[model samples]
Target: MVRASTPSTWLQGLDIPSQLFGTTGGSDYELYEEDDEFVLTIDMPGFETDEIALAWDDGMLNVAADHTDENRGRKKTYHRRFRFPKTVDDEGIAAEYTNGVLEVRLPTADSTAQGTEIPLEG
Candidate 1:
């Protein structure tokens, strides 16, 4: 017998339940700050290196994947959304995928410009 999901259970899984009724499509992510960069980690169970996409536009970072696992007959969809802090640097971003996890490194602006000095008395 197939069991149906309740409203509460469904809402709990969604990225933005209040706005979008069901669980956020696709995967879940974690963001953290290190010494000189902002890091984003996402869980992508069955994705390949080529299936993932990462981009930065209008000061926003977008990560997505089109993954399919035929053996398990699983087709996952995602619509998760997140907002970054103003301190995050949009340039000098890098991403990598390994062991079903995607890691993104965004260098902080201050960190990127650490060695440049201006001559005020020229």
Candidate 2:
């Protein structure tokens, strides 16, 4: 019996796995740093206000959206993900969905810290 030839390793490198997995979606994100806080603007079209969920855990911010059955009859698939710069305080963190866009506001470290500074002298 004759043996089959294997494809080159370089061919695998050129493979676009995101397209094959069907996780590709269009999204725009903007991160801004202010004196008291950092604001994150995420663009999520075709999503409802109640279907989005945001959480902070283990120095990471997680955002997920679950579409309802209203579009179940249509052929659609989405698997987009966004990673935040730093973990935010889960308390008082609010998410607002408007006009098919999700806006998440995160308070900075300085804003969350309270108390007086200690003086050191030598």
Q: How close is candidate 2 to the true structure, as a TM-score?
A: 0.55
Report lDDT per candidate. Answer: 0.68, 0.59
lDDT (Cα, 0-100) at 25 in candidate 2:
30
Give the root-mean-square deviation of each candidate in angstroms.
Answer: 10.2, 11.2
- Which is the leading candidate under TM-score? 1
Cα lDDT of model 2 by residue, 11-107, tens digit:
5688756446342233256667665555666777877766677767754667777675655664323344445445355565667878877777776
Error of 2 at 114 (Å): 15
Poorest 10 consecutive residues of model 2 by lDDT? 18-27
TM-score per model over all chains: 0.60, 0.55
Query: What does candidate 1's lDDT look like per residue over 4-81, in tens digits?
Result: 234565556766545454433322667777888878788887778888777777657877778777898887654344
Which one is best on lDDT? 1
